[model samples]
Target: MRIFLYSLFLLFSIVSHADGERVNIASFSQNDINSWQTKIFSGETHYAFSTMDGRTALHANSTASASGLFRKVSIELSQTPILHWSWKVDNVLTGADERTRAGDDYPARVYVVFSGGAAFWRTRAISYVWSSKQAVNSHWRNPFTANSQMVAVQSGSERVGQWVDERRDVLADYRRIFGKEPGKLDAVAIMTDTDNTGASASAWYGDIWFGAK
Candidate 1:
């Protein structure tokens, strides 16, 4: 739409780094790549998992919450950073927890915990795809907020179904939601379990990295 085009237009072409370097820490390793993230769930192939055509995730008939995140990079709690990525939903089913909560998300989500330290555990949901009920009428909305009642993660755009980049400042995002500065960003986690009901669901992730501007 005109909005996305405007976003592309208004978006800063100026590199955050004057030296023209990308600010990435750790990320998903395909070949001999490694970083500092820990495994919350090591995924395996099963009924919930299907290898059709070469895609990887914890979908129905796949394993447990084994969605992986590597290059477990950390962003300094200051210097307002941006987290960017290109992604979209492939499918949606039910979930592990069973009973739907605010999200009503079946084939649940893969969340990232952005705690100040290992002891803190505040998370950002990767989000859900359009259900037969909800049309893709809603485009992307920055600063999506979620709570106990329902989730406000739906954006308005569906095309650019291409490799679109989404950038978010970790500091500003956390402060807006939690209402304060953060501590030490411990580790980033990728969780693909189910709803609290435990029906079995998941999401997919590609190269994920965090850095400064």
Candidate 2:
């Protein structure tokens, strides 16, 4: 909810392996490993792609102002890293969003949590679309809020708006989508709505670099 260090607004990131295969956005510096610990979950002013303000029945589009909207960030990669980032989502056609609904809407996620936190996707590692308005290479059938999940990877298409590049190999993408082998990944989160769905989504992020191979 609130954890601040500002660490002078952290600025010093690494993109090693001699920066070979195109994935170096200003040599990484998304507030230095997401500022050790940050999680908003609910709202209090934070936007990069919809933070929150409530509407219902749909007719909204206002979320892009969180200085660097971060749902959660805190990394500790010691050896076993290979995660990349770059997203751009826009438009899913009026009324309800996050994938579709007129009365009970919900859906929107992108996660990776491993601090032995017990559970939140059965060991945490989700890339979601449980239900709602979908488009742009859309394909549905992933309803997992944690049902003894062993892995849930979604990315065969639907880069949402545009600009796409999400190459994850953080220990085989968490052992092929949460199967096991998450000794230490610490933290990395970017979520829009996951408190039990209230779709009104929006997104835009770019270049998140990792090392240790």
Candidate 3:
């Protein structure tokens, strides 16, 4: 009987491990923003906790501003490779060409950064953006830097004012975008900016998490 019980325990452990684990990056529902830091480029984009769709979320309002909230956390891509999040935009920008620096603005974007450490120039990033003009699933190099790439996860005004859930295989995206294996993920950031186009934008972000496939 003892041996049988031990075997049953082992089987349960294996099954639980196979189910994988989740790492929470943001818990806006619980009003948690303890570890996030703000980085401003042009001007500050106002961020606040607000109730939306019967749940709490982070709301960003940008008017000719460039700013983002970032959290530094090391994530092992081999373990938790999938990123999950939900967002909603009030409207997509008008007359903004995402392919040029002069029009590099987004109403909503969630990005992952891989640190280059001492060699800062080697740092790379992948931004999943809600584009105004680009087609969904299309990707391009950021006009500001080749080190960063942009993927249009959501596009256009067709889905405006509605919450959209997104999931991405970060490991696969990194391999495809950089043509190489990625190291540990250094940080995650979210931004809603219209500084370049000198326009205004608003967005709401739900909780974000990383999980194993």
Candidate 4:
């Protein structure tokens, strides 16, 4: 059996922004990493800093492990709902279905978590992932929890080893999937994992932020 690591979710100070202002969720610099905390599940994924395309990025290396660095925040989606970031993976995990527990792994993924409020059961999340076999733009419930949805933003090996930028409207996506207005966006997380498949993967994540049009 594979070993696992479990810990409490690390919470950070909430960030407030004015209208039309860009809010950086994670700078990923040495100073920023000090505030960002990691949660481990099924071994540990090594994370460090590396320069890519003339900018600093958080490099993740996973060998049959699952872990992620996350920061909590309070953002009003109506004002700045656009999430922007960039990531690159060495290659896709062959034969991983992503919709099955045994195949729930990804070369790269980012998560936006919403609070459940008093009910707690109302919590929800959107995981934007680079799928290995699933078609791009396809979305489904996470194998572990229906409250969390997986959306395949990037797929296949077409852009392996190359930096790819991404943008998504969290406000629109939340409404589309959950059929209701979203509460304050509670946190943002980045992960590169292969624990379920017992494989290895590597990925790099650039600056992540939320902004207006």
lDDT of 2 at 28: 22
| lDDT (Cα, tens digit) per residue for candidate 1, span 1-213 | 101112222221322221123444423324213443333333431323233235432222333333333233344546435555434344444222212332333332223334322221233322323232344322222222331111223233342132334455656655665566665443343334332233444334444455565
Better of 1 and 3 by lDDT: 3
How do the predictions measure up, each by TM-score? 0.49, 0.24, 0.90, 0.91
Greater TM-score among 1 and 4 belongs to: 4
Q: In model 2, how large is the Cα lDDT of residue 197?
A: 38
RMSD of each: 11.2, 16.5, 12.0, 3.2
lDDT of all predictions:
0.35, 0.37, 0.83, 0.81
Candidate ranking under lDDT, highest first, comes to 3, 4, 2, 1
lDDT of 2 by residue, 124-169 (tens): 4434322333432233323333321212233323545555556656
Local accuracy of candidate 4 as per-residue lDDT tens digits, 1-213: 111111212243456544457988877643357557778787899999998777688999999999887777788898899999989999889876789999999989998888666555566789999999788878898888778888999999999999998999999999998899998898888889999999999998988889985
| C-alpha lDDT of residue 154 in model 1 | 29
Residue by residue across 1-213, what tens digits does model 3's lDDT show?
Answer: 002111222222111111358988889878999878777778889999999889799999999998888777778889999999999999898786888988889999998887766565677888899999898888998887788889999989999999888999999999988899998787788999988989999999999989996
Which residue ranges in model 3 land beyond 4 Å of their true spot?
1-20
- Once superposed on the true structure, which residue ranges of model 1 sit more than 4 Å away at CA? 1-21, 26-33, 36-72, 94-164, 195-203
Worst 10 residues of 2 by lDDT: 1-10
